[model samples]
Target chain A: MFSPLIDELINALRILPGVGPKSAQRMALHLLERDKPGAAKLASSLQQAIEHVGRCKLCRTLTEQDICATCTNPQRDSRLLCVVETPADVLAIEQAGNYSGRYFVLLGHLSPIDGIGPEDIGIDVLLERLQNEHIEELILATNPTIEGEATAHYLAEQAKRLEVRVSRIAHGVPLGGELEYIDGGTLAHAFNSRQGL
Target chain B: MFSPLIDELINALRILPGVGPKSAQRMALHLLERDKPGAAKLASSLQQAIEHVGRCKLCRTLTEQDICATCTNPQRDSRLLCVVETPADVLAIEQAGNYSGRYFVLLGHLSPIDGIGPEDIGIDVLLERLQNEHIEELILATNPTIEGEATAHYLAEQAKRLEVRVSRIAHGVPLGGELEYIDGGTLAHAFNSRQGL
Candidate 1:
């Protein structure tokens, strides 16, 4: 609203998820008034990231190099592969500090209504990787939403055809979750998947 | 966390007001995965804004040129000058579509504990402008906080010395503000400032 450059900056900032017009304006003014140097650094960093970062050839996760850190790390178990919807999911799993397997990021789930199918989510590429790699177990770690479930089921069929053991990540009450607040679907899943303790 | 470039980008993004580590990570991943082109545009726009936008010489609001649009607009009431704390305040006032006077930005309010004083807020520059301009009335539109009140009182003294009429923006119940939820200070002000029907 102040100048063309500022207007452009505000519009560009709207690309960020959850940032609306008012928030974008606040961010733009904040950068201009308080942190010009930081804004410049952010600009350069954005350009560098956009130019350098791309999908890892093997896992489809974002990386500056041909392969991502997890994909190339020798310490991770190559015998087990985790399939996830996006790079964010990979970060979440890694942050938990429990999973130590290689990952294959689908980037999106299969949604036939939206015209996103197996080829759309790079299923062929995943199938090719499974065939070439020594991965004996495939863990479907996609979200528990309907699209994620459909994608997992389809991938499981492909893994079975290739004679690879496939497992879906458990759907149950979260560790800190209260049963009273847990959704019906999750509670049902927790009950159905009950194991002797 | 993924790579050096990604890490740098995330750090740079954290410069935005109110964005924490998790939000920065989410924004970075979203740009990388969903909107690379938009991210590039934002980068370029940020650089452009940093290089071009600066404080308007007259009004102290953000501008690409020597003078801001508000300062240059002949249609505005130049005889009535409004003093504010920041460019964001100017934007907020303009958005209200009621005020038509010129503006002088202090950029900050008086905070003695923080070592902020008249010079720090460009009080001398404002005084000089008042001396040279034909402004007959000075409106103290600073915020209602303690610091804002101190700044406004100080500026009022200066305006009185300059032989210009000084007025503080009224603090009353905001439009559509419910009395039941309004703070005691604001309710008292509203009652004190009650006008004829």
Candidate 2:
């Protein structure tokens, strides 16, 4: 074992996702041995981000300001709001370069067993936006899982009362995916949601 | 894409070993979103390590004090000195729980092409220890690679002049490693170094 500080650094590094004890040790030693300047930069960056970054008031996406860039951008379509599970999903949709709409990040799905519910994921704020804002279409871009489906259905029902059109993202064999390799659930969903040419 | 601060944080996270851009983004967001306290801890730990940790004066291993605990411990055998390429290797040998001798960290192996000479890896200090410290034996625990072998051979030649016994760690099929899965080079080395048991 190394000194106390080295061990502490290793333990602290394990807080990051997917890093194990061995990896933490390697990282600690690497920074100490070779990249002290990089380590210092990373430390300052983390401190600055933690001190400044907060959830956007509009869409609940993470940002340094009260409202995220995506929510405040004039070029983005205000009349269309896409709902997603996390901020990372918003990045994915943005990177796809097809959506011009604003986003409403749920942060997580409705899992009753885990005690995650409508209010927990800021569904009230979403409903308030639906009633107040002139959002014409609400796109459900949550993952194609049972919990995602349930959350989407619940949000759709809520949006319906507010007269906002709701649509779920299509589920099928992924682009370039062979049908033979596709799972039964996705294949069945694709068949059920098939549209005529 | 996220804000400038978020982007900076993500880029900074990439300095850690094995973290690519995607993983860096994930780590950045993960720390910002779910574990700000953990992030703070990591940042502070990194800062503390960089500020306080320095090489051991005797063994050249990283430690806060002038001498590392291993080098300072009186229980360890002073007459036997194990020379290794890096401090991490010292930790590895210590974890094996067999070594009770002092250590001399080379920090890196000898490489003429890269312009790394004997002095670069503290060969002069090692020779001084062999001469003045009454070291009876020198264990060359450097890696089994070409560079490691070159370094060991160089150190062995030096120690021979000082009248200190020199030995390299065994190179063969590792414990629990099947012969079929072992590489040809290692297998060949194992055959060449076969013991008379």
Candidate 3:
């Protein structure tokens, strides 16, 4: 076993996604032995972000200020709001640079078995925005997983009740994907959802 | 793009091994969204370990004190020293639980192309130990790479000059390894080094 503090560092690093005990150990040793300056900077940055960054009051994406940059930007189309499941999803959409709209981060999707509901994912906050804002469309951009589909369906019902246009992001074989190599389920879904020319 | 602080955190986290842009974003979001307390603890633990931990004087392994625990342990065999390339190697040997000898970490191996030689890896410090201490046997436990082999050969010559016995870690097929699956180089070594038993 390593010294207590080194062991603690390794254990703490294990909490990161995809990091097991061996990777954590390697990370700790690499930091301590090879990259002390980088490690120090990482620690300070983590502390600062954790201490200051909170949910944007409007979109619920993480930010140091009340509203996130994307939500507050005048260039983005406020009337065409895209709702996503996490801040990372917001980033993904932003990086694509195709969407010129604001966002509403659910922070999670409905998972009844795990006891997470609409309330748990801040649906009430989203509803309040829908009630007040002149949003022309409510885009459902959640994942293609079962829970994500359920979430999109639930949100579509809500958007219909409010008479707002609602659409799910396209799901099929990925761009550049070979049809022959595509999974059966995805291929079937693509065939079923074949678009009119 | 994320807020300044969150973006900084993601960028800082990318310095870790195997963490690319996507993984960094995922980690930053995961910590902020699902595990704020865990993130805080990790930050504090990182800061504390970096601030407190330093290389042990005797063996050059990471420790808060001057001498590492293994070098100070009374139960370990001081007369039989195992030399390794890094602190991780020390842990690997310790986990095997069969070696009772103390360790001396080289932190690196000889690489003339990289301008790293005996002095750079603290071979001079190792020489001091070999000269001052009554170590009867020195075991070369460095990695089996070319640089590691060069380092082991260099250390072997030094130990021989000091009238100390030296041996390299065994090479060839691993325990429980199927002969058919073993590589040609390892199979050849195993055949050449076959014992009387």
Name the regions of candidate 2 deviating beyond 4 angstroms: none
How many pairs of residues in model 1 come into backbone collision?
Answer: 0
* Candidate 3 chain A worst ten-residue window by lDDT: A123-132
* Residues B1-197 of candidate 3: C-alpha lDDT, one tens digit per residue: 78899889999999899999989988988898888888988998899999999999989999988798998999999999999999999999999999998989999999999999889999999989999999999999999888999899999999999988999999989999999999998899899998996
Worst window of 10 by summed lDDT in candidate 2 chain B? B125-134
Q: List the residue pairs that clash in candidate 1.
A: none
How much is A140 displaced in model 2, in angstroms? Answer: 0.6
lDDT of candidate 1 over B80-184, digit per residue (tens): 999999988998999999988899999999999999989999999999988998899999999999999999999999999999999999888989988999999
- Model 2, A86-141: lDDT tens digits are 99999999899999999999999999999999999999999999998899999999
Tens-digit lDDT track for model 3 on A1-197?
99999999999998899899988999999999989899999999989998899989898888999988888899899999899998888888888889999999898899999999999998878877888889999999999999999999999998788888999999999999899899999999999999999
Error of 3 at A90 (Å): 1.1
Candidate 2 lDDT by residue in tens digits, B1-197: 89989999999989999999999999998998899999999999999999999999999999998899988899999999999998889989989999899999999999999999999999998888787888989999999999999999999999998889999999899999999999999999999988888
Docking class of 3: high
TM-score of each: 0.97, 0.99, 0.96
DockQ of each: 0.86, 0.91, 0.85
Give the candidate number with the greatest TM-score: 2
Error of 1 at A3 (Å): 1.5
Candidate 3's DockQ:
0.85
Q: Candidate 2, overall lDDT?
A: 0.94
Higher-ranked by lDDT: 1 or 2: 2
